[model samples]
Target: MAISNVLMFGMVDFSGLLDKFGIDWHLLLIQSLNFVLVAFLLYRFGFRSVARVMDERREKIELGLKYADDMKREKAAFESSRAQRAESARREAEGIVKSAKDGAKAILEQGKMELQQQSAGMILNAEKEIARRRKKILGDAKAEIGTLVVEVAKSVLASQMTDRDRNNYAAMAEKMLP
Candidate 1:
């Protein structure tokens, strides 16, 4: 029986409750129309415009970030290239300097060797000149001594010899001479 009453209650209509609660359909309909109008106006005039501005700002920020990133990469690459070129120049300069130093050293060594050779040649020439002068002086001295000895011998023989014996001595001396 209780189950039968529960089923009966489920079937009962509750329109009388609204009347008791002082509800008005005309007022409800008007409030509903006002809410729908406010929502439509906010979406059309407020939310859509705010969303559009926010989207523009977001796109600008993204583009700016991309441009900044590209600039940073370019700067880094330029710096690296500059550094590499500088290093290459430094190495080339060092090589040029080293080669110049080596060339100077070789020239100096060659100059020294040439000077030594010239000095040796000069010394040899001086020695040869001295030997030639010595030989000439000795020859002249020998000739002078021979002439003096012959004169002294002639003076001694003139004082000692009679004319008769001197003629015979003269013949012997002449035969002994060149």
Candidate 2:
């Protein structure tokens, strides 16, 4: 029974209810027109300007975000380039040091060669000087021995021969001794 009554109430005519409530159709129509006019004015003057301002703010924010991203990428690139330059410099330094070491080694080897050559030349000069000295000593000794033999022959013949014989013997001795 309650459900039947609720359904019957829902079917009641709305025009009879409006009349009972003292609602006028002309007033309702005028109020509806007023609401529509007010909504259109607010949307045209107030809402449109506010929307424009919001759109401008949104664009600014997007541009700022894009600029920040670009800056971040640039910073990363700069850091990478700096690291590469540092690595290149380190390698160049290593190459320079290696070159210097090689140069030093070459110079050292050249010095050793020169020293060896100088030592060999000195030894050869010393040998030549020793040979010259030995020859000089031998010549002096032979001259000394020849002089002693001539003196001994003169002394031995002086005791056993006459003056002329001794003179001839001395002359022969002198020639034979030489």
Candidate 3:
């Protein structure tokens, strides 16, 4: 009977409590609806679009970073290969020089001034030819490497760039190239 009396008498009544705090139910309902509408509008019209744009920019930046890393790997590989080729060329050039000197010594053993002079001329001509071939090889390798670098840059830029980025990178690459 005590529980029933308490429940029946107004145990949950807020009327007097709300009145003491100057809270009006009608105004509270209106403000709650207003808050919901404003939140929905902000999310729909402002935050959603901004979030999408941020996501797009984030993706582009990530792709650019990945392309830069690939470029570093490719450049390292190119450098290693170029070094190997240069070392090989140097060793070959040294061997040719050594062989020419040996032949010149053999011809000098004949003890004729004319043969010695002719052998000296032959040795000098061989040295000149060796230098010419080495220079040509180095020039060809450099031209090939430069072409490969430009092609790689073009491919990377095509994949990673906006038009503005493409133009900027093209300008930069041109500046880097002779």
Better of 1 and 3 by lDDT: 3
| lDDT comparing candidate 1 with the true structure | 0.80
Best by lDDT: 2
Arranged by TM-score, best first: 2, 1, 3
Model 3 over residues 58-176: C-alpha lDDT tens digits?
99999999999999999999999999999999999999999999888877776577777889999999999999998887678666655665567768655665666655655675466
RMSD of each: 7.9, 7.6, 45.4
Q: Tens-digit lDDT track for model 2 on 1-178? A: 9998887876575657877897998999999999999999999999999999999999999999999999999999999999999999999999999999999999999999999999999999999889988777766755665456546765765566566765565456546643
List the lowest-lDDT window of 10 residues for candidate 2. 169-178
When sorted by lDDT, best at the front, the candidate numbers are 2, 3, 1
Model 3 ranges off by over 4 Å: 8-13, 22-25, 107-178
Look at candidate 3 and tell me the lDDT of residue 178.
54
lDDT of 1 by residue, 1-178 (tens): 9998886775553456677786798989999999999999999999999999999999999999999999999999999999999999999999999999999999999999989999999999999989988877766765555455455556877567566565555555555544
CA lDDT, candidate 1, residue 9: 75
TM-score of each: 0.54, 0.55, 0.52
Q: Quote the positional error of residue 34 for candidate 2 in Å.
A: 3.5
